[model samples]
Target: MTDLAALRAALQLQWALGQEILALVQREHLALTEPGQRSGSAFEFFRQRLHLLPRLEEAVAALRRHRAAWQQLSPALRRSDPEIGALLRANEDLIFRILLLDRENQQLRLRHGLLTVRAESHPHSNRSTSGQFSALA
Candidate 1:
């Protein structure tokens, strides 16, 4: 059917776009790690590289729509097209795993940031305690 064809095209386009965005992220990450490359602050580098994640998510959502449409096809059609089913399932799994890994990485980064802030603030507490008695006079 025409609708099926359109969905397939859309899914393929979404997958290709996601791959392209991931490639760009990889390239930017590698460039940022090169020695003596004082291109920008770490936060700025991370911001630029991370900008692709939302675009990837959008592409994954589009692909999921296509996959749902494919699943709703008649049983006979699905039985006759095993490759479509397999590819759809595989891509879905891959995207889901990527998103899960991204979330875990974000959580770890947040924990690291909290630890860094705590370490930086802890020394100030010692200084404040040492001066507290003198200031109370």
Candidate 2:
């Protein structure tokens, strides 16, 4: 496949992974917010998030592998390619939402006296300069 095609595919994969991560976080929030939620359920949610974080990291790694190719394109070309631009924006939005929900979940978990897990516990998770989670480019 061409470089553009490869990058496009990578973005698609990252987007899908990010969507799953976001949904999982949202569910964790729901589980935490439930007044009758069992500790076991909360722990299960935490474990699922841990396992998925690494997968998200790998997906992000794949996305970054194509960053160079994306950077090689001219600004005008990138602007004109709606599919890629929209997909990238969608992935960024997902990453932001996951971070927000995860933060709220953490706070809720803290109120419940349950320990919190950090994404940094995963060796491969990327960090953006702004300290938010890395968004797939």
TM per prediction: 0.53, 0.71
Instruction: Please list the C-alpha lDDT of all candidates, in the order they appear.
Output: 0.51, 0.65
Give the worst 10-residue stretch by lDDT in candidate 2. Answer: 128-137
Cα misplacement distance, residue 109 of candidate 1 (Å): 1.8
Write model 2 residue lDDT over 26-136, tens digit each, in one string: 776777787665344755775676678778667666655555566678888776666876777677777778877876766676567665345324446565422322211
Clashing residue pairs, backbone N/CA/C < 3 A, model 2: none
* Candidate 2 to native Cα RMSD, angstroms: 6.9
Q: What are the runs in model 2 whose C-alpha is more than 4 Å off?
A: 36-40, 61-68, 116-137
| Candidate that would win on lDDT | 2
- lDDT string, candidate 1, 41-122, tens digits: 4465356435655666576666667677777789887777676666676667656554544434333434444123433444
